[model samples]
Target: MISFVIKKGTNSNEMRENNSSLITANLLDWYKKEGRDLPWRETSDPYKIWISEIILQQTRVAQGREYYFRFIEKFPDLESLAMAEEDEVLKLWQGLGYYTRARNLHAAAKAVMDRFNGIFPSTYSDIITLRGVGEYTAAAIASIAFNEPHAVVDGNVFRVISRLFGITLSIHSSEGKKTIKKIARSLLYTEEPGIYNQAVMDFGALICTPTQPKCVECVLQDWCTAFAENRVGELPINDRKIALRNRYFHYFHILQNNSTFLQKRNGSDIWKNLFEFPLIETPLPNDFSQLVKTDFFGELFGGITLFSVDHKLAIKHRLTHQLIHTHFYQMIIPEEIPFNPPKNIFKIENEMLSDYPVSRLTHKYLETI
Candidate 1:
């Protein structure tokens, strides 16, 4: 039999009213038997836990595992990561799509060093002050690292709680959030919150998954309201749907001798600070012939009269809110022509291209040629 102590809310009456104690106990039991043996779970260090959590955001566990290992090997602690440069950090986080997370991690590491005297904050209040540390992440770190009884309400928790309670409110609504969070708080087994948090998260991940939940074998199935009502698939209602906007990019990979021009992306846009070939963005997709005739195209290569061009097949890259249709063009400029590119763009040796961090879209194009 598993024990549960309600950290918040009224008392045993509230526990019995919601059957939270039983739910929590069964969840912990399920976790003990079926929980994943992830590398992050083996340690109690807040720094490492923070790393694992940030990496796992917008990244699959399988892919993030290797990145985590490599990242830890390079910058093991807050001090190490704080001292390191942004470029080196970005380079290490090359293939990770959400570059902003890496940047925030780097910034947060420096913050930990400056604000907390190189020590990771123990309390949720202090931890949330760090960059990229939201309520979910802060709760995770505070509870898992310092044994603070802060219930983590991520997508997994949302799904599991909604199904277990057979919630019908839209998850996007404030009422839904309050209801789910309240239930989560009530169900948090406060005796060993670190273990309990991990258990609930593991139970959600392993048994009550998003798409194809193993309800038949789930320990919580008997207690699950959605299962009892035969509405498991429809309980967790989410009304938000992303409307994707399309943009077209024509990247010019101009080569003069063994060197090529690569520019660092700037501004508050996608792929900021990452290196890429000179790009001309258009409202709609355009072919090379149409692209060459554009005003922006002429401004870039107005003086360069003698050049050979070879266009590659257009590639479509999809992101959360945007769809990018990218076209890569390889141009060979003559050695004698005074080719002056944009001030932001600098010439780099073709052999040294791998040194700088680039977007995955740019990397894929590089791999082809």
Candidate 2:
């Protein structure tokens, strides 16, 4: 029934230290009773921890669970992953989107093997040097695996810190991020940094969720400035709008003599190194007749004089910042015709289709037939 709020003069060394201790103690106690039981939290192995971290990025915990298990089963240790082929790694990560993360995981594994003699880095500085590792992931690995004193400032932590201190800055801004990071460090439980880090993250996930948070039963409600000011939802401000672009892709699935044609995506585009049916991207949606008149369609089927379109499928795939409108055209070329595809295009037996890794959209199309 009492009200508690952290006001100005709270930035003083003594006041900050007192508030930090109180927050740490309360968070750890709450975590002990309400923290979610997760597989990644059970181990201090950097390999497993690193894998879980990458998989969880832009992916939900429920979805990431199976991927974490499957990936660890396939490549249990750093040595196993470093020696494995990129195709193998990508194939294992087929359904999971944001494929660049998987590639970076593989690359970082090789770096650890070659640079650190197969041992994972124990410090934040060294871990951040690996491919694809940012400050957050590096801090997580250092604290959880090595018991180092580093505060993790993930989305959860950002929200919790923002609301607790009543920060008015947009989380998307550099100044707001810097302020949150400073506050996170001040509140970190230095003695058990790993436990404290996970505790705060768990608190944010379970009690201080993004929507419909359980504020009534929240342990930090007394000290939550947003709660006192009736602005819980407005505390963690992120007003940046994502600019989404639309792309149209016409995919040709050429079937001939029990074989199909596929091309590995190259260059600095999405789905790089992944295999899919021969594709031509257009600015706007093009029908079958309009498609045949394009330069790409001409170059693709230049050698073949005749072919029949047996089936057509259209799919709209959505990404974080792009909306992909894909059309699949299945063409059956007679065995008598000698077809010479482009140099980048390669022919593979139908049975070998599943052996190559494709994007999620391609995988869905494959499931239909």
Candidate 3:
């Protein structure tokens, strides 16, 4: 039997340490039998592992699996990725939602070629220097690929650690992350940090899930403080709530002589570098009559004669922190060229629009026409 000496005002750090060891042992043992046979787990190739990690961010395992294979089939290796154009990379990642990840992945591939001689950096410090590689991603790659003893503290790890230890701190807070990182490092099985990290993540995703956890089958249930205290649902706290801002978009699909106009988004705003129709953003949703009265609309179609204007189609696209209500208007103009077009605006054959990488909203709109 384990016993603890109660010193007045002293913390129970020693007892906690002992519990962590037990948790680690039981978790790893359970993992050997129950861990999912994921494709990334079967290889130690840092490039493959890095691709899986990037694809898995904000993406479900089932969805990410298909994209992983598609990406691998397309790029094949770091060298292939580095030589490919950014547009080609984004085209492959068209349906992946987060285009920025694809962009950063392409950028990092080139960086690897230029800085590390086309080989993935092996150390934690070197891996973290890659574009869009944060602490969680760097730790994951370093530990899993290089067998480094860095403990990964991603969302899964955070949930598992918080519930097992009954930590009520907000996971979004800096102090909470630091505390969890400390606990994760202590519990990491240094002998096989790769397997251990994957095991913990699988345990959290399969057993200690966000909702409707399978507590009865969990290996660490006996020692899980939250389970014993009946606080499994309440332990892992995230008090930060995202306030979504609303934006209105009016997209004009101008067609003349079997050709349409599209412009590439160029700014720090969302969907940067993606192609879209001529856009008129307004403070609020406006009808065609009101939209045409605006000065921007006059400048856009000043010298052109419209043959017909189709009824507007509206789409509501939701992002993490923004709600976009887009109104798409189709306009057919005369074939004769009259005035100079807006900057970045160019004409493309209607059939060739599919060649461009467009936002999800634009893709959805294209499917209709």
lDDT scores of the candidates, listed in order = 0.88, 0.88, 0.88
Pairs of colliding residues, candidate 3: none
Question: Per-residue alpha-carbon lDDT of model 1 for 245-340, expressed as tens digits?
Answer: 999999999999999999999899998889999999999878888987988777788656799999864899988899999999999998888888
State the number of backbone clashes in model 2.
Answer: 0
Candidate 3 yields a Cα-based lDDT of 0.88
Query: How does model 1 fare in lDDT?
Result: 0.88
Order the candidates by TM-score, highest first — what do you get?
A: 1, 2, 3
Residue-level error in angstroms, candidate 3, position 367: 1.9
In candidate 2, which residue pairs get closer than 3 Å at backbone N, Cα or C atoms, i.e. clash? none
Q: What is the lDDT of residue 138 in candidate 3?
A: 93
Error of 1 at 354 (Å): 0.5
Task: Give the Å error, residue 226, model 2.
Answer: 1.2
- Candidate 3: list runs displaced more than 4 Å: 1-11, 303-305, 336-340
Note each model's CA RMSD in angstroms: 3.4, 2.3, 2.9
